[model samples]
Target: MTDHETNETAAEVKVDRQRPETPSYEEVLFYERKPAGFWVRFWAYLIDLLVVTALTSILVKPVFALVGLETSGVPWYAPYAILSALIFYGYFVLMTKFFRQTVGKMIMGIRVVSLKTDDLSWMTLLFREWIGRFISVTIWPLYWIVGFTPLKQGVHDYIADTTVVHEESFRKNKLLQKKTPDGSGLHETSAF
Candidate 1:
Protein backbone atom coordinates (compact mmCIF):
# COMPACT_ATOMS: atom_id res chain seq x y z
CA MET A 1 0.00 0.00 0.00
CA THR A 2 1.04 3.64 -0.44
CA ASP A 3 2.65 5.35 2.57
CA HIS A 4 -0.18 7.95 2.79
CA GLU A 5 -2.89 5.29 2.84
CA THR A 6 -1.01 3.34 5.54
CA ASN A 7 -0.65 6.46 7.74
CA GLU A 8 -4.38 7.36 7.32
CA THR A 9 -5.45 3.85 8.43
CA ALA A 10 -3.24 4.07 11.53
CA ALA A 11 -4.66 7.50 12.40
CA GLU A 12 -8.24 6.19 12.12
CA VAL A 13 -7.40 3.37 14.51
CA LYS A 14 -5.89 5.80 17.01
CA VAL A 15 -8.92 8.08 16.83
CA ASP A 16 -11.31 5.18 17.40
CA ARG A 17 -9.37 4.10 20.47
CA GLN A 18 -9.30 7.57 22.00
CA ARG A 19 -12.95 8.38 21.39
CA PRO A 20 -15.45 6.87 23.79
CA GLU A 21 -18.25 5.19 21.90
CA THR A 22 -21.82 6.15 22.73
CA PRO A 23 -24.79 4.14 21.58
CA SER A 24 -27.03 5.69 18.95
CA TYR A 25 -30.74 6.03 19.64
CA GLU A 26 -31.59 3.63 16.81
CA GLU A 27 -29.42 0.97 18.41
CA VAL A 28 -31.20 1.47 21.71
CA LEU A 29 -34.68 1.10 20.19
CA PHE A 30 -33.83 -1.81 17.88
CA TYR A 31 -35.17 -4.43 20.30
CA GLU A 32 -38.08 -2.25 21.42
CA ARG A 33 -40.91 -3.24 19.12
CA LYS A 34 -43.93 -2.92 21.32
CA PRO A 35 -45.84 -0.19 19.54
CA ALA A 36 -49.17 0.82 21.06
CA GLY A 37 -51.97 -1.09 19.43
CA PHE A 38 -55.36 0.20 18.31
CA TRP A 39 -57.33 -0.19 21.52
CA VAL A 40 -54.72 1.45 23.70
CA ARG A 41 -54.11 4.33 21.34
CA PHE A 42 -57.82 4.82 20.79
CA TRP A 43 -58.48 4.95 24.52
CA ALA A 44 -55.65 7.38 24.99
CA TYR A 45 -56.99 9.63 22.23
CA LEU A 46 -60.46 9.53 23.72
CA ILE A 47 -59.14 10.52 27.11
CA ASP A 48 -57.11 13.29 25.51
CA LEU A 49 -60.17 14.60 23.66
CA LEU A 50 -62.11 14.78 26.91
CA VAL A 51 -59.25 16.54 28.64
CA VAL A 52 -58.84 19.03 25.82
CA THR A 53 -62.55 19.66 25.59
CA ALA A 54 -62.73 20.47 29.26
CA LEU A 55 -59.70 22.72 29.09
CA THR A 56 -60.89 24.46 25.92
CA SER A 57 -64.28 25.19 27.39
CA ILE A 58 -62.73 26.68 30.48
CA LEU A 59 -60.20 28.75 28.55
CA VAL A 60 -62.47 29.85 25.69
CA LYS A 61 -65.10 31.25 27.98
CA PRO A 62 -62.83 33.97 29.29
CA VAL A 63 -61.51 34.90 25.86
CA PHE A 64 -64.96 34.94 24.39
CA ALA A 65 -66.27 37.06 27.20
CA LEU A 66 -63.47 39.56 26.71
CA VAL A 67 -64.36 39.89 23.04
CA GLY A 68 -68.10 40.11 23.91
CA LEU A 69 -68.78 36.88 22.04
CA GLU A 70 -69.79 34.92 25.12
CA THR A 71 -72.78 37.22 25.69
CA SER A 72 -73.61 37.68 21.98
CA GLY A 73 -72.08 41.12 21.17
CA VAL A 74 -69.31 39.75 18.93
CA PRO A 75 -68.55 40.77 15.34
CA TRP A 76 -69.70 38.50 12.51
CA TYR A 77 -66.11 38.03 11.40
CA ALA A 78 -64.88 36.76 14.73
CA PRO A 79 -62.89 33.53 14.32
CA TYR A 80 -64.05 31.41 17.22
CA ALA A 81 -63.51 28.16 15.34
CA ILE A 82 -60.01 29.18 14.39
CA LEU A 83 -59.23 29.98 17.99
CA SER A 84 -60.41 26.56 19.05
CA ALA A 85 -58.36 24.90 16.37
CA LEU A 86 -55.27 26.78 17.46
CA ILE A 87 -55.83 25.77 21.06
CA PHE A 88 -56.21 22.13 20.11
CA TYR A 89 -53.07 22.17 18.01
CA GLY A 90 -51.08 24.00 20.64
CA TYR A 91 -52.16 21.62 23.38
CA PHE A 92 -51.11 18.51 21.52
CA VAL A 93 -47.89 19.93 20.08
CA LEU A 94 -46.65 21.50 23.28
CA MET A 95 -47.57 18.64 25.54
CA THR A 96 -46.11 15.94 23.33
CA LYS A 97 -42.99 17.96 22.65
CA PHE A 98 -42.19 18.60 26.28
CA PHE A 99 -43.56 15.54 28.02
CA ARG A 100 -43.38 12.91 25.27
CA GLN A 101 -47.04 12.17 26.04
CA THR A 102 -50.26 14.07 26.59
CA VAL A 103 -52.26 13.65 29.78
CA GLY A 104 -54.40 10.95 28.22
CA LYS A 105 -51.43 9.13 26.76
CA MET A 106 -49.75 9.34 30.15
CA ILE A 107 -52.82 7.81 31.77
CA MET A 108 -52.78 5.03 29.17
CA GLY A 109 -49.00 4.55 29.57
CA ILE A 110 -48.31 5.45 25.95
CA ARG A 111 -45.93 7.97 24.44
CA VAL A 112 -45.12 9.34 20.99
CA VAL A 113 -41.68 8.56 19.64
CA SER A 114 -39.72 8.85 16.44
CA LEU A 115 -39.51 5.62 14.48
CA LYS A 116 -35.75 5.99 14.20
CA THR A 117 -34.78 7.82 17.39
CA ASP A 118 -35.09 7.72 21.15
CA ASP A 119 -36.01 11.37 21.80
CA LEU A 120 -38.73 13.36 20.09
CA SER A 121 -37.87 16.59 18.27
CA TRP A 122 -40.00 19.72 18.00
CA MET A 123 -40.44 19.50 14.23
CA THR A 124 -41.36 15.83 14.50
CA LEU A 125 -43.87 16.61 17.23
CA LEU A 126 -45.44 19.37 15.16
CA PHE A 127 -45.84 17.20 12.09
CA ARG A 128 -47.08 14.28 14.16
CA GLU A 129 -49.50 16.19 16.33
CA TRP A 130 -50.75 18.89 13.97
CA ILE A 131 -50.24 18.34 10.27
CA GLY A 132 -50.57 14.58 10.36
CA ARG A 133 -53.60 14.82 12.63
CA PHE A 134 -55.25 17.38 10.39
CA ILE A 135 -55.00 15.00 7.48
CA SER A 136 -56.23 12.09 9.58
CA VAL A 137 -59.22 14.07 10.70
CA THR A 138 -60.07 15.22 7.21
CA ILE A 139 -59.66 11.70 5.88
CA TRP A 140 -61.02 9.60 8.73
CA PRO A 141 -60.18 6.19 7.31
CA LEU A 142 -56.51 7.04 7.32
CA TYR A 143 -56.56 7.06 11.09
CA TRP A 144 -58.35 3.73 11.36
CA ILE A 145 -55.64 2.01 9.37
CA VAL A 146 -53.59 1.93 12.54
CA GLY A 147 -55.49 -1.19 13.56
CA PHE A 148 -54.15 -3.27 10.70
CA THR A 149 -50.61 -1.88 10.48
CA PRO A 150 -47.79 -4.01 11.83
CA LEU A 151 -46.37 -1.12 13.82
CA LYS A 152 -49.83 0.22 14.65
CA GLN A 153 -49.05 3.48 12.86
CA GLY A 154 -51.82 5.42 11.26
CA VAL A 155 -51.35 7.70 8.27
CA HIS A 156 -50.34 10.50 10.60
CA ASP A 157 -47.70 8.41 12.25
CA TYR A 158 -46.32 7.38 8.90
CA ILE A 159 -46.28 10.94 7.68
CA ALA A 160 -44.29 12.03 10.68
CA ASP A 161 -42.12 8.92 10.75
CA THR A 162 -43.30 8.42 14.29
CA THR A 163 -45.11 5.76 16.27
CA VAL A 164 -46.97 5.53 19.51
CA VAL A 165 -45.64 2.91 21.84
CA HIS A 166 -46.59 1.56 25.21
CA GLU A 167 -44.14 3.35 27.44
CA GLU A 168 -44.02 0.57 29.97
CA SER A 169 -43.28 -2.01 27.32
CA PHE A 170 -40.47 0.12 25.96
CA ARG A 171 -38.95 0.58 29.40
CA LYS A 172 -39.31 -3.08 30.15
CA ASN A 173 -37.39 -4.16 27.09
CA LYS A 174 -34.09 -5.48 28.36
CA LEU A 175 -32.11 -4.14 25.43
CA LEU A 176 -33.46 -0.62 25.78
CA GLN A 177 -34.09 -0.36 29.50
CA LYS A 178 -31.84 2.08 31.30
CA LYS A 179 -31.51 2.73 35.00
CA THR A 180 -31.39 6.12 36.61
CA PRO A 181 -28.32 7.29 38.45
CA ASP A 182 -30.18 6.44 41.64
CA GLY A 183 -30.96 2.93 40.38
CA SER A 184 -34.67 3.69 39.88
CA GLY A 185 -36.43 2.34 36.83
CA LEU A 186 -38.18 5.63 36.17
CA HIS A 187 -36.75 8.27 33.89
CA GLU A 188 -35.80 11.59 35.41
CA THR A 189 -37.86 14.64 34.65
CA SER A 190 -36.58 18.11 35.32
CA ALA A 191 -38.22 20.10 38.11
CA PHE A 192 -39.04 23.57 36.87
Candidate 2:
Protein backbone atom coordinates (compact mmCIF):
# COMPACT_ATOMS: atom_id res chain seq x y z
CA MET A 1 0.00 0.00 0.00
CA THR A 2 1.05 3.60 -0.48
CA ASP A 3 2.34 5.55 2.58
CA HIS A 4 -0.64 7.97 2.32
CA GLU A 5 -3.14 5.08 2.42
CA THR A 6 -1.44 3.56 5.51
CA ASN A 7 -1.56 6.94 7.31
CA GLU A 8 -5.24 7.37 6.54
CA THR A 9 -6.03 3.84 7.86
CA ALA A 10 -4.14 4.54 11.11
CA ALA A 11 -6.02 7.81 11.67
CA GLU A 12 -9.39 6.13 11.16
CA VAL A 13 -8.49 3.28 13.56
CA LYS A 14 -7.52 5.75 16.29
CA VAL A 15 -10.72 7.72 15.82
CA ASP A 16 -12.86 4.55 16.23
CA ARG A 17 -11.38 3.72 19.64
CA GLN A 18 -11.75 7.32 20.87
CA ARG A 19 -15.52 7.27 20.45
CA PRO A 20 -17.41 8.02 23.67
CA GLU A 21 -19.64 5.48 25.32
CA THR A 22 -23.38 5.92 24.94
CA PRO A 23 -25.26 6.43 28.21
CA SER A 24 -27.84 3.99 29.63
CA TYR A 25 -30.71 6.10 28.41
CA GLU A 26 -29.17 6.15 24.96
CA GLU A 27 -28.70 2.41 25.12
CA VAL A 28 -32.30 2.01 26.23
CA LEU A 29 -33.33 4.10 23.29
CA PHE A 30 -31.20 1.94 21.06
CA TYR A 31 -31.71 -1.34 22.93
CA GLU A 32 -31.99 -1.90 26.74
CA ARG A 33 -35.43 -3.58 26.51
CA LYS A 34 -37.94 -3.63 29.33
CA PRO A 35 -40.78 -6.08 30.07
CA ALA A 36 -44.38 -5.39 29.12
CA GLY A 37 -46.83 -4.56 31.83
CA PHE A 38 -49.77 -6.78 32.79
CA TRP A 39 -52.77 -5.83 30.56
CA VAL A 40 -51.19 -5.00 27.25
CA ARG A 41 -49.56 -8.32 27.77
CA PHE A 42 -53.03 -9.45 28.80
CA TRP A 43 -54.44 -8.31 25.49
CA ALA A 44 -51.92 -10.51 23.77
CA TYR A 45 -52.58 -13.28 26.25
CA LEU A 46 -56.31 -13.09 25.75
CA ILE A 47 -55.73 -13.24 22.04
CA ASP A 48 -53.71 -16.40 22.36
CA LEU A 49 -56.25 -17.92 24.67
CA LEU A 50 -59.07 -17.05 22.34
CA VAL A 51 -57.25 -18.33 19.30
CA VAL A 52 -56.30 -21.54 21.01
CA THR A 53 -59.81 -22.00 22.26
CA ALA A 54 -61.28 -21.40 18.85
CA LEU A 55 -58.83 -23.73 17.15
CA THR A 56 -59.12 -26.58 19.61
CA SER A 57 -62.85 -26.19 19.60
CA ILE A 58 -62.88 -26.35 15.83
CA LEU A 59 -60.67 -29.42 15.77
CA VAL A 60 -62.05 -31.36 18.72
CA LYS A 61 -65.76 -30.60 18.68
CA PRO A 62 -66.23 -31.81 15.11
CA VAL A 63 -64.41 -35.02 15.81
CA PHE A 64 -66.56 -35.64 18.84
CA ALA A 65 -69.70 -34.85 16.89
CA LEU A 66 -68.66 -36.94 13.91
CA VAL A 67 -67.81 -39.97 16.02
CA GLY A 68 -70.54 -39.51 18.63
CA LEU A 69 -67.83 -39.50 21.24
CA GLU A 70 -69.19 -36.51 23.12
CA THR A 71 -71.36 -38.76 25.19
CA SER A 72 -70.20 -42.21 24.04
CA GLY A 73 -67.85 -42.77 26.94
CA VAL A 74 -65.72 -39.61 27.16
CA PRO A 75 -67.17 -36.76 29.20
CA TRP A 76 -67.69 -33.22 27.91
CA TYR A 77 -65.68 -31.29 30.51
CA ALA A 78 -62.96 -33.93 30.39
CA PRO A 79 -62.18 -33.22 26.76
CA TYR A 80 -62.28 -29.52 27.40
CA ALA A 81 -59.70 -29.72 30.19
CA ILE A 82 -57.35 -32.36 28.75
CA LEU A 83 -57.59 -31.17 25.18
CA SER A 84 -57.36 -27.53 26.12
CA ALA A 85 -54.20 -28.22 28.11
CA LEU A 86 -52.48 -29.93 25.20
CA ILE A 87 -53.66 -27.41 22.64
CA PHE A 88 -52.77 -24.38 24.71
CA TYR A 89 -49.37 -25.74 25.71
CA GLY A 90 -48.58 -26.77 22.15
CA TYR A 91 -49.73 -23.46 20.74
CA PHE A 92 -47.76 -21.56 23.36
CA VAL A 93 -44.59 -23.50 22.56
CA LEU A 94 -44.88 -23.13 18.81
CA MET A 95 -45.73 -19.43 18.71
CA THR A 96 -43.32 -18.33 21.42
CA LYS A 97 -40.41 -20.28 19.92
CA PHE A 98 -40.87 -19.93 16.20
CA PHE A 99 -42.96 -16.78 15.77
CA ARG A 100 -42.03 -15.09 19.06
CA GLN A 101 -45.68 -14.26 19.53
CA THR A 102 -49.14 -15.74 19.08
CA VAL A 103 -51.67 -14.64 16.48
CA GLY A 104 -52.99 -11.98 18.85
CA LYS A 105 -49.55 -10.76 19.75
CA MET A 106 -48.68 -10.66 16.09
CA ILE A 107 -51.80 -8.62 15.37
CA MET A 108 -50.98 -6.38 18.33
CA GLY A 109 -47.35 -6.12 17.16
CA ILE A 110 -45.91 -7.42 20.44
CA ARG A 111 -43.33 -10.09 21.15
CA VAL A 112 -41.59 -11.73 24.07
CA VAL A 113 -37.88 -11.28 24.69
CA SER A 114 -35.15 -12.50 26.93
CA LEU A 115 -35.02 -10.84 30.30
CA LYS A 116 -31.69 -9.12 29.73
CA THR A 117 -31.28 -9.30 25.97
CA ASP A 118 -33.70 -8.43 23.20
CA ASP A 119 -33.61 -11.87 21.60
CA LEU A 120 -35.57 -15.12 21.65
CA SER A 121 -34.62 -18.81 21.44
CA TRP A 122 -36.39 -22.15 21.39
CA MET A 123 -35.01 -23.26 24.73
CA THR A 124 -35.79 -19.91 26.29
CA LEU A 125 -39.29 -19.99 24.89
CA LEU A 126 -39.88 -23.62 25.80
CA PHE A 127 -38.65 -23.44 29.35
CA ARG A 128 -40.38 -20.15 29.99
CA GLU A 129 -43.68 -21.43 28.61
CA TRP A 130 -43.53 -24.89 30.16
CA ILE A 131 -42.68 -23.35 33.45
CA GLY A 132 -45.57 -21.02 32.79
CA ARG A 133 -48.08 -23.88 32.46
CA PHE A 134 -46.74 -25.85 35.37
CA ILE A 135 -46.24 -23.09 37.90
CA SER A 136 -49.09 -20.81 36.99
CA VAL A 137 -51.70 -23.54 36.69
CA THR A 138 -50.52 -25.47 39.72
CA ILE A 139 -50.45 -22.35 41.87
CA TRP A 140 -53.87 -21.02 41.05
CA PRO A 141 -57.27 -21.88 39.61
CA LEU A 142 -56.26 -20.39 36.32
CA TYR A 143 -53.05 -19.02 34.84
CA TRP A 144 -54.84 -15.70 34.34
CA ILE A 145 -52.97 -13.85 37.05
CA VAL A 146 -49.72 -14.21 35.18
CA GLY A 147 -51.19 -11.83 32.65
CA PHE A 148 -52.07 -9.50 35.50
CA THR A 149 -48.69 -9.67 37.19
CA PRO A 150 -46.09 -7.06 36.58
CA LEU A 151 -43.93 -7.76 33.56
CA LYS A 152 -46.80 -10.06 32.64
CA GLN A 153 -44.86 -12.84 34.27
CA GLY A 154 -46.48 -15.68 36.11
CA VAL A 155 -44.93 -18.13 38.56
CA HIS A 156 -43.00 -19.89 35.79
CA ASP A 157 -41.43 -16.67 34.64
CA TYR A 158 -39.79 -16.56 38.01
CA ILE A 159 -38.15 -19.89 37.32
CA ALA A 160 -37.18 -19.02 33.74
CA ASP A 161 -35.83 -15.49 34.20
CA THR A 162 -37.94 -14.32 31.32
CA THR A 163 -40.22 -11.34 30.83
CA VAL A 164 -42.94 -10.53 28.32
CA VAL A 165 -42.69 -7.20 26.58
CA HIS A 166 -44.90 -5.31 24.19
CA GLU A 167 -43.72 -3.88 20.89
CA GLU A 168 -41.73 -0.63 20.88
CA SER A 169 -44.80 1.47 20.17
CA PHE A 170 -46.63 -0.13 23.07
CA ARG A 171 -43.81 0.61 25.49
CA LYS A 172 -43.64 4.22 24.34
CA ASN A 173 -47.40 4.49 24.63
CA LYS A 174 -47.17 3.02 28.08
CA LEU A 175 -44.61 5.62 29.10
CA LEU A 176 -46.84 8.36 27.77
CA GLN A 177 -50.04 7.10 29.41
CA LYS A 178 -48.23 6.43 32.67
CA LYS A 179 -49.53 2.92 32.18
CA THR A 180 -47.81 -0.43 32.03
CA PRO A 181 -46.62 -2.56 29.15
CA ASP A 182 -50.02 -4.17 29.40
CA GLY A 183 -51.66 -0.80 30.03
CA SER A 184 -52.34 -1.50 33.68
CA GLY A 185 -51.36 0.97 36.39
CA LEU A 186 -50.01 -1.77 38.59
CA HIS A 187 -46.61 -1.07 40.20
CA GLU A 188 -44.60 -4.24 40.35
CA THR A 189 -41.25 -5.91 40.05
CA SER A 190 -40.04 -9.32 38.96
CA ALA A 191 -40.19 -12.38 41.19
CA PHE A 192 -36.77 -11.42 42.43
Candidate 3:
Protein backbone atom coordinates (compact mmCIF):
# COMPACT_ATOMS: atom_id res chain seq x y z
CA MET A 1 0.00 0.00 0.00
CA THR A 2 1.05 3.61 -0.56
CA ASP A 3 1.96 5.90 2.38
CA HIS A 4 -1.34 7.77 1.97
CA GLU A 5 -3.27 4.50 2.07
CA THR A 6 -1.48 3.44 5.27
CA ASN A 7 -2.33 6.79 6.90
CA GLU A 8 -6.00 6.44 5.90
CA THR A 9 -6.16 2.92 7.37
CA ALA A 10 -4.61 4.10 10.65
CA ALA A 11 -7.12 6.92 10.92
CA GLU A 12 -10.00 4.52 10.28
CA VAL A 13 -8.70 2.20 13.00
CA LYS A 14 -8.45 5.13 15.43
CA VAL A 15 -11.99 6.22 14.68
CA ASP A 16 -13.30 2.73 15.19
CA ARG A 17 -11.54 2.47 18.54
CA GLN A 18 -12.97 5.80 19.68
CA ARG A 19 -16.57 4.95 18.87
CA PRO A 20 -18.71 3.52 21.65
CA GLU A 21 -20.58 0.27 21.03
CA THR A 22 -24.31 0.67 20.99
CA PRO A 23 -26.26 -1.29 23.58
CA SER A 24 -28.13 -4.34 22.40
CA TYR A 25 -31.91 -4.33 22.15
CA GLU A 26 -32.25 -6.69 25.12
CA GLU A 27 -30.10 -4.47 27.31
CA VAL A 28 -32.13 -1.41 26.35
CA LEU A 29 -35.31 -3.32 26.98
CA PHE A 30 -34.36 -4.76 30.38
CA TYR A 31 -32.21 -2.13 32.09
CA GLU A 32 -34.62 0.67 32.82
CA ARG A 33 -34.68 1.67 36.53
CA LYS A 34 -37.16 3.74 38.50
CA PRO A 35 -37.31 4.97 42.09
CA ALA A 36 -40.19 4.29 44.52
CA GLY A 37 -41.56 7.25 46.43
CA PHE A 38 -42.69 7.93 49.99
CA TRP A 39 -46.41 7.17 49.93
CA VAL A 40 -45.91 3.80 48.35
CA ARG A 41 -43.05 2.99 50.69
CA PHE A 42 -45.15 4.07 53.65
CA TRP A 43 -48.02 1.82 52.71
CA ALA A 44 -45.64 -1.04 52.13
CA TYR A 45 -44.07 -0.48 55.52
CA LEU A 46 -47.45 -0.53 57.21
CA ILE A 47 -48.14 -3.84 55.58
CA ASP A 48 -44.72 -5.04 56.66
CA LEU A 49 -45.41 -4.02 60.26
CA LEU A 50 -48.53 -6.15 60.30
CA VAL A 51 -46.73 -9.07 58.74
CA VAL A 52 -43.73 -8.81 61.04
CA THR A 53 -45.93 -8.41 64.10
CA ALA A 54 -47.77 -11.61 63.27
CA LEU A 55 -44.60 -13.45 62.48
CA THR A 56 -42.87 -12.26 65.61
CA SER A 57 -45.85 -13.15 67.73
CA ILE A 58 -45.97 -16.65 66.34
CA LEU A 59 -42.26 -17.25 66.72
CA VAL A 60 -42.10 -15.70 70.17
CA LYS A 61 -44.93 -17.78 71.48
CA PRO A 62 -43.04 -21.03 71.04
CA VAL A 63 -39.83 -19.62 72.48
CA PHE A 64 -41.72 -18.22 75.44
CA ALA A 65 -43.40 -21.52 76.02
CA LEU A 66 -40.08 -23.36 75.79
CA VAL A 67 -38.55 -20.97 78.28
CA GLY A 68 -41.51 -21.32 80.63
CA LEU A 69 -42.14 -17.56 80.39
CA GLU A 70 -45.68 -17.76 78.97
CA THR A 71 -47.43 -17.95 82.33
CA SER A 72 -49.91 -15.23 83.26
CA GLY A 73 -48.54 -12.20 85.20
CA VAL A 74 -45.08 -12.78 83.68
CA PRO A 75 -43.24 -9.68 82.41
CA TRP A 76 -43.01 -9.80 78.62
CA TYR A 77 -40.81 -6.83 77.80
CA ALA A 78 -37.36 -8.45 77.84
CA PRO A 79 -37.95 -11.49 75.65
CA TYR A 80 -40.35 -9.63 73.40
CA ALA A 81 -37.88 -6.83 72.70
CA ILE A 82 -34.96 -9.17 72.10
CA LEU A 83 -36.91 -11.47 69.86
CA SER A 84 -38.44 -8.56 67.99
CA ALA A 85 -34.98 -7.20 67.20
CA LEU A 86 -33.78 -10.59 66.01
CA ILE A 87 -36.88 -11.11 63.90
CA PHE A 88 -36.60 -7.66 62.41
CA TYR A 89 -32.98 -8.12 61.43
CA GLY A 90 -33.49 -11.63 60.14
CA TYR A 91 -36.60 -10.75 58.18
CA PHE A 92 -35.15 -7.68 56.51
CA VAL A 93 -31.66 -8.96 55.84
CA LEU A 94 -32.63 -12.37 54.56
CA MET A 95 -35.60 -11.30 52.47
CA THR A 96 -33.97 -8.24 50.93
CA LYS A 97 -30.81 -10.13 50.13
CA PHE A 98 -32.59 -12.99 48.44
CA PHE A 99 -35.84 -11.49 47.13
CA ARG A 100 -34.90 -7.81 46.81
CA GLN A 101 -37.87 -6.89 48.98
CA THR A 102 -39.77 -7.72 52.14
CA VAL A 103 -43.24 -9.26 52.14
CA GLY A 104 -44.68 -5.78 52.40
CA LYS A 105 -42.48 -4.32 49.72
CA MET A 106 -43.28 -7.23 47.48
CA ILE A 107 -46.99 -6.77 48.04
CA MET A 108 -46.61 -3.07 47.28
CA GLY A 109 -44.71 -3.81 44.04
CA ILE A 110 -41.37 -2.47 45.19
CA ARG A 111 -37.80 -3.78 45.39
CA VAL A 112 -34.53 -2.79 46.99
CA VAL A 113 -31.38 -2.45 44.93
CA SER A 114 -27.78 -1.76 45.74
CA LEU A 115 -26.48 1.34 43.97
CA LYS A 116 -23.15 -0.43 43.58
CA THR A 117 -24.24 -3.67 41.99
CA ASP A 118 -27.05 -5.52 40.23
CA ASP A 119 -27.33 -8.16 42.96
CA LEU A 120 -27.66 -7.51 46.68
CA SER A 121 -24.84 -8.47 49.09
CA TRP A 122 -24.70 -9.64 52.69
CA MET A 123 -22.82 -6.57 53.95
CA THR A 124 -25.27 -4.23 52.28
CA LEU A 125 -28.20 -6.19 53.63
CA LEU A 126 -26.79 -6.15 57.14
CA PHE A 127 -26.11 -2.44 57.07
CA ARG A 128 -29.37 -1.48 55.45
CA GLU A 129 -31.60 -3.82 57.41
CA TRP A 130 -29.87 -4.36 60.74
CA ILE A 131 -27.84 -1.33 61.76
CA GLY A 132 -29.50 1.31 59.65
CA ARG A 133 -32.95 0.16 60.60
CA PHE A 134 -32.01 0.18 64.24
CA ILE A 135 -30.94 3.78 63.93
CA SER A 136 -34.08 4.74 62.02
CA VAL A 137 -36.32 3.04 64.51
CA THR A 138 -34.55 4.65 67.44
CA ILE A 139 -34.67 8.02 65.78
CA TRP A 140 -38.08 7.90 64.19
CA PRO A 141 -37.64 11.23 62.36
CA LEU A 142 -34.95 9.73 60.12
CA TYR A 143 -37.52 7.62 58.36
CA TRP A 144 -39.39 10.72 57.26
CA ILE A 145 -36.47 11.76 55.11
CA VAL A 146 -37.87 9.40 52.55
CA GLY A 147 -40.68 11.85 51.96
CA PHE A 148 -38.33 14.74 51.13
CA THR A 149 -35.41 13.06 49.39
CA PRO A 150 -35.24 12.91 45.63
CA LEU A 151 -34.86 9.15 45.44
CA LYS A 152 -37.00 8.53 48.54
CA GLN A 153 -33.96 7.30 50.50
CA GLY A 154 -34.25 6.81 54.22
CA VAL A 155 -31.54 6.42 56.84
CA HIS A 156 -31.24 2.73 56.01
CA ASP A 157 -30.91 3.38 52.30
CA TYR A 158 -28.37 6.12 52.86
CA ILE A 159 -26.24 3.98 55.10
CA ALA A 160 -26.23 1.16 52.59
CA ASP A 161 -26.17 3.22 49.37
CA THR A 162 -29.33 1.50 48.19
CA THR A 163 -32.70 2.54 46.81
CA VAL A 164 -36.28 1.31 46.71
CA VAL A 165 -37.79 1.27 43.25
CA HIS A 166 -41.03 0.44 41.48
CA GLU A 167 -40.72 -3.24 40.53
CA GLU A 168 -43.04 -3.35 37.53
CA SER A 169 -41.61 -0.20 36.01
CA PHE A 170 -38.13 -1.59 36.42
CA ARG A 171 -39.15 -4.96 35.08
CA LYS A 172 -41.12 -3.61 32.12
CA ASN A 173 -38.15 -1.57 30.81
CA LYS A 174 -39.81 1.78 31.34
CA LEU A 175 -37.82 4.96 31.71
CA LEU A 176 -36.44 5.57 35.19
CA GLN A 177 -37.75 8.37 37.39
CA LYS A 178 -34.39 9.04 39.01
CA LYS A 179 -32.05 11.96 38.44
CA THR A 180 -29.95 11.56 35.37
CA PRO A 181 -26.18 11.96 35.24
CA ASP A 182 -26.67 15.65 34.48
CA GLY A 183 -28.88 16.01 37.58
CA SER A 184 -32.18 16.45 35.75
CA GLY A 185 -35.55 15.08 36.92
CA LEU A 186 -37.82 16.70 34.36
CA HIS A 187 -38.17 13.74 32.03
CA GLU A 188 -39.79 11.06 34.21
CA THR A 189 -42.98 9.48 32.83
CA SER A 190 -45.26 6.59 33.74
CA ALA A 191 -45.75 4.55 30.60
CA PHE A 192 -46.88 1.53 32.58
Go through the candidates in order and give each one's C-alpha lDDT.
0.79, 0.67, 0.80
Candidates sorted on lDDT, descending: 3, 1, 2
Which candidate has the highest lDDT of all? 3
Q: Estimate each model's TM-score.
A: 0.66, 0.58, 0.66
Candidate 3: 10-residue stretch with minimal lDDT: 22-31
Better of 1 and 2 by TM-score: 1
Candidate 1 ranges with C-alpha deviation above 4 Å: 1-33, 70-78, 170-192
Question: Model 1, 1-192: lDDT tens per residue?
Answer: 999999999999999999976533211323464889888988988898998888778988678777767524445355766676787889899999889889999999998888778788887887888889999989988888999997899988998899888876743232344345556454533221
Q: What ranges in model 3 sit over 4 Å off? A: 1-31, 70-77, 170-192
Model 3 lDDT per residue over 26-141, tens place: 12234556689888999988888888888877888778878777534546467667777688778878888888999999898999988889888888888898889889889989
**Residue-level lDDT tens digits of model 2 in 1-192:** 999999999999999889964322111122334566656666776788899878887987778778765623455468656776788889988987887778888877777676756666666676778776677657774556565666667666666677666576443212212224555554443221
Which residue pairs of candidate 2 clash?
36-165, 37-181, 37-182, 39-182, 40-182
Where does candidate 2 have its weakest 10-residue lDDT segment?
A: 22-31
Output the TM-score of candidate 3.
Answer: 0.66
CA error at residue 56 for candidate 2, angstroms: 1.1
